[model samples]
Every structure is written in C-alpha cells, then in structure tokens.
Target chain A: MDEEIRARRAACTDTFLGNGLIRPRELLASIDPETDPDTYGEGGVVTELERHVAALLGKPAAVFLPSGTMAQAATLRVHADRRLSRTVVWHPYCHLDQHEGQAHQRLHQLIGRRTGDPEHLIALGDLEEVAEPVAALLLELPQRDLGGALPAWDDLVGQTQWARERGAAVHLDGARLWEASAGYERSPAEIAALFDTVYVSFYKGIGALPGCCVAGSAADVAAVREWRARLGGTLFALWPAAASALRLLDEGLAEMPARMRHARAIWDALAGVPEVRVVPDPPHTPMMHLLFAASAETFRENARRLAEETGLWVWPSGFATGDPDVVRAELSVGRATLRHKPEAIAEILSGLCM
Target chain B: MDEEIRARRAACTDTFLGNGLIRPRELLASIDPETDPDTYGEGGVVTELERHVAALLGKPAAVFLPSGTMAQAATLRVHADRRLSRTVVWHPYCHLDQHEGQAHQRLHQLIGRRTGDPEHLIALGDLEEVAEPVAALLLELPQRDLGGALPAWDDLVGQTQWARERGAAVHLDGARLWEASAGYERSPAEIAALFDTVYVSFYKGIGALPGCCVAGSAADVAAVREWRARLGGTLFALWPAAASALRLLDEGLAEMPARMRHARAIWDALAGVPEVRVVPDPPHTPMMHLLFAASAETFRENARRLAEETGLWVWPSGFATGDPDVVRAELSVGRATLRHKPEAIAEILSGLCM
Candidate 1:
C-alpha cells in the first residue's frame, strides 16, 4: 500500500482501537498463524466468548450471529410470536422501515405500522391513535436518521406504558444506545430497564469487532435463543471476541461525554463556515451532521483528495438527505479524529470548500 | 475446566481450526498479548473478527450479529416494503414458521403463505396454485423438518422462474446446502445461481466458527447490505476468527461426498438395530434422522450418558414431531465423526438400546 493509504488505514484503525494509529506492520505483528481455523475445535474459545456477551447484556443466553439484520429480525419475530400478534409499530424512519426492504413482511409474514411522524421521535400519542392492535412497538433511541435525537425520559416511560397497556411488547433499537446514554446521563441498564427487550451493538461507540446483544426477561430471551437456532443463528462455537471488546472498549462509554463535547465543538466551529450547514444543530449526541453546499459526488471527491493528499480521513462519504445539493457528512469524534482539535478540522473544511 | 470439559473444548476447537481431534491444541500455540481486544483495542479480537466477516460476506457489508434470528429477520424486512406486496411463501416447517414465532407477520407487516407439502418438496405446482402475490419465496434445500430431501433440479428452476415471472423474488434457505450439494453433486455456485438470493451457514457441514453468508447478484446483495445497516448489522468492526474458520474448513466441502458416503454406511448399519428407525433410510444426504423408542428427554439422557462413557456425541433430541415416544437424532457426519467406522457407531447404538 502507498504511504497515504497505509496511514489512512492506520488512522481508521486507531480511531476504532482508541490508541495511536496501529500501522499495518503492527497488525501483522499480532497474528498467530498456528491458531488459524485449520487447527481449532468447536466450542473452544468461541463458545466462552458468546457466554461472556450473553452475561454482559444481562440475557439468560446469547448466540453469536453474522449480522444484526438477522439478530434484530429474529428477536422481533420471537416477541411477535410470544404475543401472537401480527402488527409492529415504529417511527417512519425506523431502521426496520427505511432500511430493511420489508424483510419481516417478506419472510416472517409480519406487519409493520409506521406510527409516528416522519421528522420527529415516535410519541405515545401515535400509539394511542393507532386503531390496530400491535404485537410490538419498536423504539429507536436517539434516532439515527433524525440526527440522534431521543425522546424525553417521561415520553419514553409513557410510550412503554402505552404499548404495554395494549398488550404490546416494547423493543429498544439501542444500536447507538451507548451514545444515547451519554446524552441522557443514564446508565445502559437504566435505559434498557424501561423496555421489554433491548438491542445494543458492540461496534459503534464501543469500537469492538462487529457484534450486538439483545437483552430482556429470561423467558423472552430464551424464546429468542430458540428462534436464533431455527433461523440458523446458532454457531458451532464462538469465542470471547465480543466480550473482550465489551470489556476493553466498554470503557469508551465513560469517555463518550468527552467525545460528545468534542463533537459539539466541531459542530460549533463548522457552523460558522459560509458553505456549511449543520443538521440537528448543537449536537444531541457525539454524532452530528454537516450539510455541504457541494454535490455528494464533489464532496466525496474532495474528501478522498484530502485523505490522499494530507493523510487525514475526515467525514464519511455519500450520506443521503432529502435535499440533493446538500451533501451530508457525519462528524463522529473517535480517538483519532479527536486528535486534531476543532480548529484543525475547521481549517480542513475551509480549505476543501475553497 | 475439568479434564473432560477441557478435552471436549480442545476437540471442538480442533474441529473448527481444521485439524482432527488430536491435533486441535496445536492451533492456539501462537499468541500475542498486545493485539488482544481485552488488553488493547476497544473490545477485542471478536469485534475485529466481525469486520472481516462483514467484508467477506460481500456486504457493504457485514456485522458480527449475535444470532441468525436477528440476521434473517432483518434481511427479510429489508425485502418486504410496505408499499410492496407483503407476503413470504416457504415450506411448512421453515425455520421462520416453526421456530421464529411468526416474526414475519408480527414484525414486518408481511403475511406468510406456507405453500409446499410436508411430505414432498416445493414444486412449481405449489407456486402456480397460490392466488395472492408474495414478496418472496423461500426455498430450503434438503428441507430440514422433512426428511433431508431436495426437489428435482428442474422443479427448483421452475419454482424460481414462476416466482420471478410474477415480480416476486426467491430466497434459498440453504442452511444445509453443503450436504445438499454433496447429495446433488453440484457446486455451491451452481446451486446458488438458481435463486435471486441465498443464505448459507458456516457451522453445519463446514464445521467452522459459527457464521453465515447471504449471497446474490450485486444489486440484490447491495439492497440486503443497505438493510443490514438499517437493522444494526453494520457493527463498527468484525472478528476475523469466523472468516479464518471459513478459509480453513471450506476445504471440507470437497471432502463432503466422502462423509455422505460414510453417513449412508452408518444408516445401512443402523437399519439392522431393532429399536432404532432411520428416516429416508440409507440417507438422502450426509445427515439422517434416527428415531428411537424413547422420549426426547430419555434420548437426551442416554446420549449424554453415552457421550460421558464413550467420547462420542450422537444427537437424537426429539424435534417437533407428532410421536411422543419417538426421539429424533440427526446423524451429521463430519471428518471427525467419520473417524469411527459405521459398525462402531452401530455398536454404540446397540449398547444405548440395552
């Protein structure tokens, strides 16, 4: 790899690893060829790893899966089955609606009701207004598409109550719950406690290898375990990889407030730029959005050029917004990106725009 | 761990790492502390491993999910859009129906039409009889709940053609495709080429760290990728451990016919045992069902005892069949299981009956 690409990879790894950039050479130094799959057994280290994650999530059990799409869909299916209801309610922009092409509809024969307004958090009023009985209400905390905004604590409590009173289960799409918790000043357990089921990702704020945990009452989770096996989620073995990431990067939860602070600073610095417009301005969580006047293609080209020319990987490319000219870029403040102060980022943005 | 448990663990790891039981310990001989997720990076090796898997699955493209329930459900939802026809059709004993609690109906606003007969494979005749439009048709090769059997190749092709002619897509629940491939004597690519999409698992015939892959044409897989992100499958990173296993154990695919031949041998030998009944006698694939006169619980106890006494694991945990006294055990012969001769397995079964 070229020096620039190598540096970029190191920087990306560093942001995730939460240390100084780990060079390609350093990554090579860590591999053990002897431990390759050709020599391992089933239920060895992998099984122990799965067990640790299950414990951390406070679920009676956990099964390691290949993707969250399978995990969340399966979990929701279990909840729906337990209640014997066919309808699930969530916001219009909820991941299940906007992203999963309706797999639930295609595969499980379930119905999803887009309950709330497109631009706002799902409210209890939306649930109350819906005439059809639902099996579950899925709540995405600090909703990602809406720029990481979460409903108030009372609203969340009321929403849960509203769903339960109607015999529906509440599921928290806590993918970004780590960041959401920082904004709420609530513990993971505290936020998760409100919902009948909670789904949390290991990779996002925690920066572990990609994985997630769905926690709930023992019976509910047990049902999920059975569903997981039927859906082919049960692997022959798992290791402590997710658990190790949880133990190591879980400390990042404590560090999130600082990252959020940094995000706010970056947002503040960039907002003053004539060509830059910030979405959900002031930043509700560690993640914020910057809308550039340039087209997405141009914005991506400029970002790639900056990375190639200056050895800095700032801003992800090709984020979508309703507006065509407004190129959306997420400002996620990890250890590596946080290395350069808001001023440094501002300088780069200004230079790119020029 | 006790010596027995430790030995079991070592054996399992060896199976995953690609060596037979005795050589399993040799896989983990190399270790570097600095790269350990618990010691340095945010989470640990598992998290990193997930990222590698995400990339390998050709997802934009992966998450180390906790279960397939979540993974498949998420993928199904992505396929079933609200404005689109919200229906999925599969066999009667499909994992989503028998296992996932009607999640498709409860979660995605999709309806399920169980099209095929329990005794026969899904045919184009089944698809032609359906009146309502469906979003997708799920095909499980070597249908698990039924005796391990497959539809005629032309029939499978006809089913996919029928579904797509109506603008509906076809999905292959190839959980046991490896065995099915051996039975069919076709390549994975050849089998996969038939459907609009396919879901394959790593742990079954491959005997790797548990993982799965959903592959399709670029556009279809691309859509699944987007859904994966929305459903929380987009973890920050992934563990390469499962990928490592895939790299190593995929070679076993070439050797599957040998295993299938051995499975038939075991089936033939067991047919002579008075108390034991084999389904699809002589074996349709490498896996076969051995029904016993005891109940599932009794069968489990006996199997456990047998495992304790002799280092062999023969599974006959009763499934959702009608007979109470019947215990169903699947004989899935891998390289390790094949180590013992068919007569040896038969001798063990004879002892269990006494």
Candidate 2:
C-alpha cells in the first residue's frame, strides 16, 4: 500500500495542501544567494532570523535550530536545569511523548508526565492534579493530534498560571502558533507573553525550509545555543534555511487570517455532507481533521481515482480511528484550497465517502 | 582583532583559501532544482546519498546526518551498547573530546579515555597500555588538529587488529578522508574496510552543504538512525544538503589528487622562504600547517594589508603554538589556491612574516 502511493505520486498535478508537495528546491531558489551563510549557527541570516524572531515573540533573545524536536528538548532541558526538577508535564498527545522517540528521557535525562486526557485540551484541573514538582509545563498551541484545537483564552491563562504558581516554568510548543494567532485574533507575541519560553516552527505555518527557533530571555536562549552545539544542531551553514524562512515568513503570516477564514468556509460547506465530520467544527485554526465514514481501502481508492481523473492530489491514505469503518485525514488550508469554492471542495471530499 | 577582520571581509575580491571566503550560494546553485527533497531524512536525495555512500564505503547501510558530531556520537554509542562497555578510547584532540561540548559524556553517558600523546597519532603501544575494557577505538584519518596528518598504513592496520582482538569495534573519523584517500593513494572503501563503522564528512572536502554519512552493517546503521532521531538530527527535509553533496561529491573526489600535488608544490616552494615553516614537511595530505615566524599582531596586520592591497583574503588570525612569537595557519589546497603559481603563493605568504 505504501509502495502504491510512491508509484503514483508524480501523476498528480495539483496538491490539496500547504504550498506544494515537493518544495525544497523552489524554497532554496527563493533565497537571496548574496546573504552570508551562518557558521556554526552564528552570524549572517541565521543571527538576523534569531533577532527578528526574538522581537516577534517579544522575548529578550532567540536561537535557531535544525528541528522543533531539538528546539523543544533543549528549551525544556534549560528550564529543568535552572529549576532543578527533572519532571516536565505535558498533554498525552504532545510531540515529545508521541513523536520524539523519548529523546527527553534518553538524551536529556528529563522525565515526561502526561497531565491531560488524550482526547481533550489540557485544563487547569489537570495541571493542578500533578503532585510532583515540575521544571516546566509544555503546552502546544492548536494541539495537532486533537485536530488543531486551541483552548479558550481564559482557560489557556489558567493552565499556565497553575504551573507558574507551583514554580514550574511554562513552555510553549507553538509549532502551529501562527495558526493559533489567526484563531485568537491575537499577535504571536500576545499569546507568547504568557510563557517563560516559546518554540515555534517555520516549516509548518511559515511554509519555510525545515527549521525552528526557541525564544526566551537572553540567558536561557544562550544556554540552548550551547545545547544545540552539543546536540549537533549547529550546522556549518544554516543560511539557506534561515534565508528561506526570511523569504516566506512575512507572506505566510499575512495570509494566515485569510486561510483561517477559508478553513471556516470549507467546514461550513461540509456541514451539508452527512458522511464527513470535522473535529472542532467551525475550525479554530487554519487546519482541521476530517473523519470519513469509509474504510481505509475505500478512502484510498477514492483518493487515487480523484488524483487520476482530476490531476488533483488529496490524502493518499488516512490515519485509522477507533471505529474500523472510519478514517481520518488532515486539511490545512493553503493557496490551492483557496483556489476552489468552499461548496466545490465539500463536493470533492464527499466523493470519498462510502 | 576579530572585529578588524569582520570589518575588512567584504573588501576582498578573491580568497586565498578553499573554494572562496563565502561559498554557500554557489554550492546551492549547482544543485538540480528538480531533485526531490527528503522527508525526515528518508526518500529523495537523502536516501540516494545514503545508498551511494554505503556502496562506496562497502557497508551494508548508511545514514545521513546534519553534522559529524551527531554521526560520531551515535556510532560510538551503538558500538558501546553492543560491547557492553562504557569506555571509548580516543586521541585527546579528537572532535568528540575537544569540540562537541562533551556530548559523549553528557548526552550519551559514555566515558572517553584518551590513550595517545596529544602531539602524535594513537600508537599501538598506547592501545596496549589501556587495561580496562574498551568498547571502540576512534581513529581520525588525516587528523585535522594535528596538521592533517595520517599514521603509517602498517601501523594503522596493526592498531585496528589489536582493537578487534580485544572485541572492540574500530571506528573511523574520516572527516577529511577524501584528502587522506589521495594521501594514501587508496580508495575510501579500502581504508573503511579496516573499521566496523565509518563516518565521512561532505562539507569539508566535498565543498557541499553541511552534512555527513555513517556507513556500517545494516543493524548498526539502523541503531545510529534511531539515535539520530532521538538527538533531533533528523529534520523534516535534508534534501538541500543531500542534493548539494550529490552534485559535488564526484567532482570533489576527482580533484583530490591535483589538490594533493598542489599542496606539495606549495610546500616545496615555501621551503625557500626562510621565514615560513611547513609542518609534516612536503605535505602528506592536501592540507598542511604553515607556522609563521612572527607575532600574532604582526600576522593580523599583514593579513589585513594583503587583503586591502591585493583583494585576496587569507587567514585573519591563527592558532597559537607553544612559541609566543609563532602562529600557525592551515592551508588546504583548493580551487582558489589552484589559481596561483606555487612561487607566487610563497611570495604572498612571505609578505606576512616579520
């Protein structure tokens, strides 16, 4: 099944997702070749990016890293070292626990404790119930695994406050903070202000080359920079990634609010499609998850047929759900989705249902 | 002194060094934009690079990494875990010991035991002296810190055999193996065959984007791949670096012999200059050290004046030696250096002396 998708990938002409399917070369082409390359993640566009991100996040400093996994781990480790507590609290579906191969424990000697239910956002009560001391509370803006849902503003504040009162530094896994910014009608800095440290990814919401930055006080960021060097995240030249981020960052941010609106339009139209359901219906951010009332095989066959007939690429296969009959797919509103009318997209997606 | 160099860097028209003073953009432009980007260091050019490197090194598998620091650390841990030993033997000036922020000790909890004299390659006698159990013996080909030196081929074979007899895996830190290949007149695979695992760097000699590959048996490479993910060396896309390496690797290897001869040409020419001395005289590799019989301040002032007058950038400052009056600079024969006659380069270098 996996091999089938690879065989047919090049057949599709238009991708129904962010930017394009294969984009590194185009991203590199967009960069200003004249920009001096970074040496060991220092000088040139890398430093410029750090300074710009620090200002955007309203933090005293920032450090660029190869991946969000590295950024988040180093930030958490720095906070833990400062507070002298190894336990860090997070939601059950957070990237650190689910996707990072236990790097926090294996590489950094930090312990991760889940505080929230698997299906819901982290609440004040969940954080308060944690009995042990915590070095940091890791919060994901627009929690990805929960279908890009962000908690209400006051509830968000309450959760952070609980950790702060208990001497735990609040750290943000803001990989999708740009999407959250549009959802909350707030600047990234406004949401970031509540956290002691923030790690935002450029590759996702910013549509840049793969890279991220951890922003916080000058002291904390300096420490992460050292950790980055130790972890080998400091490459000889980070300028290409930095330059790509610089090139697309402004346009990506400016287009997010419209993407958020576009997302709502699609969801609202899908309301008439009985076989398709959206989590966090009405769409809290520019992204959402769609549940199709069809088996995985049925969904994949439909997706392949659509790609072959219309030259339009959709999710090849989807994540399995608790119900064997249903499959889940992610749709993050982007330029291609904006090209079609909301009613038209709903019709296309409806074609996938059994 | 650093500020002065930074201020005059842009004034130079040509660089008296490898490739050029600033080379990232040119290296990127050489890559084919149509090449697919890697996803999490899998597929696309990243996999292509891994497969190509594994076959070239005569290994079963390989993994592409962002830096040699991560590659070497992961490889060492893999060997240690298999041997059930925590101690890894190395030279005092090895990258893991001197440059990687003690990552082996801090991140992996592996104890490093330096067994050789700081001034020479690891001698067979040094290995016999270590009575403790050893997990691996790390040997750097064309040892970068020691003026890009190599041990005698017979002695190298003897050392690895001793480690193998003790049930210790031999690992090659072949960061400059391309240079060493030309020096030894041996294929990289020929040298790599003596070790259980081999790490080769592309950024230094290949003049490509910053990246490296670890080649070994399928199981060991898989283990290092897992460690790479844990350490966050796995980015969303490693294509740009991988593609750049693919584009330049063949040409870089083909040019090594010429560069090696050019290095000896310069060395022989410098023999007449009286004020300059060459370490490992007559040059074993394409890279060698030039010890200037002048104070640090004098070297800086002369380098600045040379840059201003000839528009040729040279080393701004040099590593201090035991002698207060002498400073050491490395010259690795490259495209930029190839443009000049050996006598002309010698005259230019002579200008820097008191």
Candidate 3:
C-alpha cells in the first residue's frame, strides 16, 4: 500500500494488459519504413492509414492526429462551428468533461452541458431536458467510465434521432470503438453510422503507438485537418505510429470478439465469488470494472503479494470509488489476460479476498 | 519540374540541411530504447531532456510539448491568465502571426497586435507606440522571415524592459534559437534571460525529431505541462523524440557557430553576383534570404533544371516576396550544406542565373 511496495511491484512485473510498456527500439522495430515512407504526415503511410480507417468506419474521409483529446475537440468544434453554437451536450463522465482540463471551454470556447448521470449511459429521456439549442451531442460508445456499458440499440438510435431533430450534430467519442463493436455484434462502420463524426484511438484496443483518426465527411475532415494544424496536432512525421496502427488494425479488430468472449467467461467465473462484483452484471464489452469489497490497503497488499508470487501483475491502487471499503480495477481482456484462464483468475480473486 | 525529372534528381541526393526528412528505420536506428524506455513522457528521457534544455536556456524548469505551435499558445495563455490581459504584441511575421492560422485568437482567446515592420526587426521605439496594455511581447530571435535579422543587443534589452515596465510578460519564439545564438555571440541563456517564457524547437536548427520545450519558472512549466495534457500533447511514449533531441542538442549547438560562419561565407560569395541579392547583406545567423531578380515561374524552372542536372534539390518555389518579378529562398547552413563549399554553391548559382 505504501510507495516503496508499489514501486517494487511495478519494477518486478512483466504483466500489463495492452502493448505493455515497449522499449523505444522494440516499438520502432514493429514498424516497416520501406512500406511506410514518412511525410509531414500528409501523403505517405498516414494518408494510407487514414483512408483505410475511413473506409472501415464508413466515412467519406479521415485525418490522423497525435491524440484522441485533440481529435475529439477538433471534431466537435467543427460540428459546433457549422451549426454556429458553442454548447456541446454529453454525459458528465465523458473524457472532454473530466480528463481534458476544460479545454472545451478554455481552448475551443465551447460550453459543456451534462445530459446523463455519470454512473450510467445516456437514455432517450435525457435529451428532452435541454433548454437551449445545442451544437453537438457527444456519445461515448460503451460509456467507458461506467464499465463499458452501452445503451440498448433502440435507445442508441433514438438518441441520435433526438439530437438530429434538434439540429444538433451527433459525435461519437469512440476511443475504444474496436472493442465495443464486438459487444454489439456489428461492424464498426454500422455503429459509426449513427454519428456525424467519430474519433477512434489506435493505442487502446488496437495496441498501436498513441494516435487517433477522426472520420467524417470529406469537408468536415478537411476542417479537422485545418484544426489539427492549428491545435499543433499535425506531426512532422506520423509514419511510425501510422505503420504500427496499420499492422494492428485488422489483427486487433479480429481479436476483439474473442477477447469480449474471454471477458464474459472471466466475469461469469468471478460472479460466484461473494467478495467480487462485476460492473454491468455481465461484461458489456471487452472491458469491465471489478469492485472488491475490501479496504484499499488490503486490495493493494493482496494484489502486490499475488504479483510477487505469481509474476502476474495487477494494479496496486484501485480507481477511486469514493468509498473507503470498495476498490475498483478495470479488467480489459487482451493477449496478456489470455495467458490466465478465467477459473484461475477467479480462484486468485477468492484467495485474495480471504 | 516534371515528375520523372524530380524523381531522378531525388534518387541520388543525400540532402537535408535540417534533420533531412528521416525515414522511419533510420530514425529508429538513432534511438536506444534500452537506455530510453517508452513513457507518457514522465520521469524518463523526456524529463532528462527537459532539464537539460531548461538549464541550457538558464531557466528554472522546462516542459516538453509536441509542437512549437502548442508550446507558444500555452505559454502565452499562461502569461495572459496571470496578467488578466488577452492581447499579445509581436512582429508581423512571427510564426504565431503568420503560420498558425490565428490559433491564438481561435483557440486561446488571445488577440495579437502586430508590431514592427515585417521587413526589419523590432526596434526599441516600436514598443512605445502600443496604445494599450499587452499581456505579452513575443520576440522571434534572428527574425526568421526577414533573412534571420536580429535587433542589436541593447535594443533587444530595451524592448524587453519596455514590455516589463508596462507589466507585460516577454516571450521568445526561439524556434531557431541555436542558430540565432551565433548571431548574438552570446550564450542561449543570455538571450533567454531577457524573456519570461522561451520556447525552443528540437526539429529546427537542432535537427532533431519534431518536438519543442518551453523553458521558464517551475510554476509556469508546470502550468504548461497541465496545458500539454489538456492539448493531448502528452504522447504515450515521447522517448524517441526526446532521445533524438538529446543526441542533437550538444552536436547542433557546437556546430552552430561554424555554420553561421559558413552562411556568411556563402552569402559573401554570392553577393557579387548581379542577379542575386542577399537579405541582411552579411547574414545574421546561419540562415539568410536569397532573392533573385526573376519571376516565380522563371525561378522555379531554373531551380528545377539545376536540380535535374546536378542532383541538387533546391526548393521548387521561392518564398513570397509580393513582387511578381522577384523570388526568394532561405539558405540555412548545416551539416548537409557543409558538403558543398561556398564557392561551388556560388558557381552553381551563377550558372543557374545564366
């Protein structure tokens, strides 16, 4: 629970859920420069990757940016500009609301109006309470903060239509859309079709170097490109990240459905444990939160001890639940989790609780 | 030039004055991951690099950002917030003024008031006429757009004093500070000490990968870091660029003095040519503007022909001179330029003009 013990566990563990802390050369070695000549990210591998992602998302065009924060902000700003409104409606737990330090207001000069409860996904009834004409309504696929829970398909469609009827653009903060798509049992493009602009991250489920692409209409993407340049999101060369993303796209996407199945299997195994509670009851996507009915100190000590003995690393500290007794850890099923069977992990959890 | 001709010329050239459009593998080969592990740019190589840059510039602290555009915008906004002023004063040709598509106004909510003549550097008297209190006075060392021209040191000091006396912060847009330092014949710290915030680019005269560091007081740098995260300038791994920058910093800084000498030598050799006019006459830094007494069409044709014949790639089009009969090219001397002697370049110029 202390800093020294936390440091020791991190230093000793080789287990991480995603792309797992690659060394510079190992990360670079994964990229093929011969097939991916560099540009100022204009017309080389970046453009190729953009086109491929655009096609996959069923959008007219796409532009790659260094981060999802910039991509989403730029996309929503473009949507807002078209409608000449400065207000964006979204759930309070959306990344733009919490993680981005109010850049939506400070940098983009847009005001955010929260529409849904932070602990749950948006409902159709949530849109009816808006008092002003909104520029855009941002929807996060799978509602990451709520353990990747998604609204029902009917409600999802109705939400988009609700915003459209108000002349508000629908934007998707689909940072983990690849993993979420498997839960819906639909192609990414089919889910993406519900939004006017969709921002997907390559780093999360794709296991690529950090980068993202905003896919939308050609005109909108062009505007985002201009904003990308303005936001300093245009890199001198994105080929390295683009090459890595291209290699992961098909592989990562194909693996997601299986990963989701693996997640469900793990959730089912753990459900019988009295000390463990899986958020959303059944896993909605490849990710879900596990809340331990234990103190933070107890959770950290047990996780550290388990890692030291088993060489399987888990987080030392839980994401805050604002409750002293309940500790939360997000389980994102990836190649790393595939190494441990669901039954074994469930047994470990039962042992840790004891 | 025709596509085939351009392709043929490019095949044999070893080019590049500034970092030279690095291929992915070649760039990767230059980095050592074992020594520089991947990070979200926390306390690893990026922190080390930031410390080194801050010390080099004689600042208390520094934070790395993905681009100069973001670095400057964030820095100026930080200054503006402290002063509760939203207006910035700078040269008409400052990068923030010309290149950034008014991101200051659009994103940062800061209005820019252009000062000084675009054809010359800022004079001390120029600051006196500002009718309103300003948030910051941004100075670009070696006034890049005006043939790398710099104001005399006394005038530069007086200009900084003038802004400070008015309770405004002074920020340095030192993208080419390494080369510009040679013009002042002063340590970088000496120049940086004249400003409250200074931004240095790694990809410019340093020839590193694309990135920048803003050096200032610890609090300001911390604010910049916060803005960096908000701007999504925090990469999952910034080690590659940081390592590349550390490699170049000492080498580039050492080479800059000689590079300045080489620039002047080349300028002097070409000064006697009837068709050529070297801006700033003797050259201010390792870069200067070469104006030709020819139309853009003529200049492009001649430069293309020379490249096709000599396997030397000159810019296809000259920088805008506002005169249809005149064209300009900026010559930035570096390791690549060292291969061709000043006399040879002059001879080539003479032949091309003929």
Model 3: per-residue Cα lDDT over B21-131, one tens digit each: 345566666566564443567766788899999999999999988899889998999999898689999999988889988888888889999887877788887888898
Per-residue lDDT over A51-143 for candidate 2, one digit per residue giving the tens place of the 0 to 100 score = 999999999999999998888998999999998789999999999999999999999989999987999998988877888889999999999
TM-score of each: 0.64, 0.98, 0.95
DockQ of each: 0.18, 0.68, 0.57
Query: Per-residue alpha-carbon lDDT of model 1 for A1-354, expressed as tens digits?
Result: 334443454444223113345332333333333332211213543445446655655556555554466567767887888776888998898777776667677556678899878987887778889987789999988888877887889999999999888989888888888788887888777787778788877656665545566777778767766555544444443333444343544567778888888878887788678787666777788776667777777776776776666656555365767887777766566655567778777767665544
lDDT score at residue B25, model 2, on the 0-100 scale: 62
User: TM-scores of the first chain across all predictions?
Assistant: 0.83, 0.97, 0.95
Instruction: Give the runs in model 1 whose Cα sits over 4 Å from its true position.
Output: A1-173, A184-186, A189-199, A214-245, A264-284, A291-301, A316-328, A341-343, B1-174, B184-200, B210-250, B264-281, B291-302, B309-311, B316-328
Task: Choose 1 or 2, whichever is better by DockQ.
Answer: 2
- Full-model lDDT, candidate 2: 0.88
Give the TM-score of candidate 1 (chain A).
0.83
Each model's C-alpha lDDT?
0.64, 0.88, 0.83
Which digits, one per residue and each the tens of the lDDT, describe model 2 over residues B172-225?
A: 999998899999999999999999999998888788889999999999999999
DockQ of 2: 0.68
Candidate that scores best on lDDT: 2
Deviating ranges (above 4 Å) for candidate 2: A1-3, B1-4
What is the clash tally of candidate 1? 84
